[model samples]
Target: MHLFSLTCTDFAAALHQGWGKGMFHAAAIYRHVFKQGNPDLAQVPELAQAGILTQELQSAFNVSSPAIAAMAVQEGVTKIVFSLAGGLRVEAVWIPMPRRTTLCLSSQAGCRMGCAFCRTGALGLLRNLAAEEIVGQVYAVRHGLGRAIDNIVFMGMGEPLDNFDNVAQAIRVLSDQRGLDIPHSHMTISTAGLTDGIRRLGELGWPGLNLAVSLNAADDELRSQLMPVNAIHPLAQLKQALQDYPLRKKGVFFIEYVLLKGVNDSRGHAARLACFLEGLPVRVNVIGCNPGPDCLFESPGEEHCRLFCAWLAGEGLFVRMRSSRGQDINAACGQLGGPAH
Candidate 1:
């Protein structure tokens, strides 16, 4: 069993069943493993006090993280490639800002969404990561890189809702008060128009958890061409899902629009987008497309992006221009993939 895969309550139950330990002892173990960054059960002083041998715990549970295969840093952004079992790999990015640092995490080894603008889609879906693997990314960055992650975004290598079970469990583990203590308010899950997953997440009723929808184009035909998921869940269905999504007080949905030159950056496109988002409480985040090597699309000019945002704002919608980070090292948006890419 992977120790990191278990939640605090699950851990407590395991300890009770295996060694007749109390819930408080499980809490102590959680502190040692997650808060103190000590994965070795032998080093947990509380476990020793409970007369639990290190060998017994070791034989039952594995507390190992994936090996870091490669790391690249450009500007204030750092991308870490973790080599998982069976030679599969995933990437997570550390984005530092003046106010808060955000950690972008991957939900799977590769992506199956097949969005035309993203590099990870080129790899197809390899496998969904386990809860331990998902949580390990946070631990690896916090402990290995020694970076303070103030926020977490599931916008790295894969569509998070595709691996909803593992991702949800990872959130529970990450937010446990006895462990990492990061709240749901600091976490955001982005999807590429997965209506069912969006509705499922809403049904979870997780308060303060943010949701971002990648809507590159407002019109169904254009969006369907850019994102294959759109062909399945068209604009009408996606809009209905958003309309039904539960948002906390003072919470608003985030609409991520990647601007491609001469493609989806026109003022007319922005007007259609505003119309598409007419009833939703959303803040539009306009980002220039991060075109990696041999990409079919091109990033829009700064003035063009500015104009697009202006158009959205003119419609009385909240808008923000997100500047690309780590583009020089191919760690920007839509650029995460294996080392070979």
Candidate 2:
């Protein structure tokens, strides 16, 4: 059994069947592993006191984190490349803001969504990460890299909802008070408009969990051209899913709009976006495209971005222009796993 893969409750159940121990013992083990940053089962004093042999515990559970292959720092943003089994690799970013430090985690090795302007989509779908591997990123960040992360965002290599099960399991493990203890409200799962996954997530009733959609375009024809997922879950259907989503009281959806120069940055596009977001509780995050190594699109000029946000605000929509960070290190939005690899 992979120790990092199981939540505290699951671990307790496993221990109950193996050594006839109760939840207290499992909680003690979890406190050592997650809270104390010790992964060696042999080093857990609780197990030793319970008459469990070190060799026996080692034989039953596997504890490990991803190996850090490379890392780069630009300004305060740090990008970490992790080497996983089978020679596969994935990337995560550590972003430090004034209030909270955020970690952008990858749900898959590569993406299959085929977003026209995204760098990770160019690599295609490599494989979905297991629950252990998904949770291991947090372990590697906290214990391996020694960084303090207060927030988590699934906005890296792949579309998060495509790997919904593993991501959900990881969230459970990450939110355990005896473990990492990061609140569900601090975690955001961004999707490429996977309506079914959104519905399934809504069914979990984690009202504090945040949801964001990568909505570069408002119209179906243009959105379908930019993001192929739009072809599967059209704009109308996606809008309905958001409307039906059980958002926490006073919580608002985050609409990520990557402004591609001369593509989706025009005033008309802004107006269309305003119309599409009408009546929805959302905060529009406008980001200029991050043109990594050989991207076909160009980043929108500052003046253009300013005008676009102005138009949206004129329509009474809450808008914020997100500054691109880690572009120098290819760690910015839509820039992971690009030609730098």
Candidate 3:
């Protein structure tokens, strides 16, 4: 048995004791309670295990419980929304594909970035989720899904760079070999082109960690209209920052282009994009725009999206028409902001 210092990590772990937190490590936690009473228990369950456990702690020493604890895994989709200690709600989505299950985790609650088209930033920034709050998303997902999620993407709710420290700590926790043991190679952190923040990420020396810039526009003027942060951290500086973005031993970063109709989906925009991406070995994940209350943004028609992608691909760029997932549940990219409607 090990005792962790009451560090920020420990603080986050302590908060995870209750609340909608703790996923697989809930077993490790159950293991802790077991060690207190029995001093040794089955440390871990094998990979092929399934089902659930309801640890109804005695009333005399009660901890915490949600009104309901629903546990089931289907279609390899084991998703759990962890309501944190302060009405801060973020989630981790585990989608089991034929070969792997990826976890989509949130870093903040309401985003402050105010990216006009994104739903998450609609409320304009609650507070930065703690490192624990950020990491707890994964922990709770592990508990709910009852399996090791293969991939992690920080494309959930908040603007991670704003809550920079906590997000960084949570990344450390996620990649830590001690608990979750998620390899850095399989994890990704996407930012809305925060240049200084990207520079810091490079300075941190996260080997094999993937960096994604949400560059939905090709020029600064249009980009500022979309991502206000661009007004402060211009794309020119962002490009210089990327130039310094210590690419991990031959790692390829990504530019996430959310294709908006009549916005950044034109031949001129594609050319600007190709030029913007000059002298960089990178890939672009072209995502069709998702609808929001601010319906001014339109997803490019299928033909247009394909044509733009073809043009960029012809320019010798690595491009992927990223598959849109969970739209039926309103759980697609740039979704997952408010209460389920």
Q: How accurate locally is residue 119 in candidate 3, as Cα lDDT from 0 to 100? A: 81
Which candidate order results from sorting by TM-score in descending order? 2, 1, 3
What is candidate 2's lDDT per residue for 60-147, written digit by digit as tens? 8877888888888989799999889999989999999998899999999999999999999999999999888878898999987789
Using lDDT as the measure, which candidate wins?
A: 2
Clashing pairs in 3: 23-139, 23-142, 23-143, 24-142, 24-143
Every model: Cα RMSD to truth: 1.1, 1.0, 7.4
Cα lDDT tens digits, model 1, 81-199, are: 99999998899999999999999999998899999989999889999999999989999999777899999999999999999999999998888888888999999999998999999
lDDT of 1 at 286: 97
Report residue 96 deviation for candidate 2 (angstroms). Answer: 0.8
Pitting candidate 1 against candidate 2, the one with the higher lDDT is 2
Q: Per-residue lDDT tens digits of candidate 3, residues 174-233? A: 665545667888888899988878888888988688988899897999999999989999
TM-score of 3: 0.79
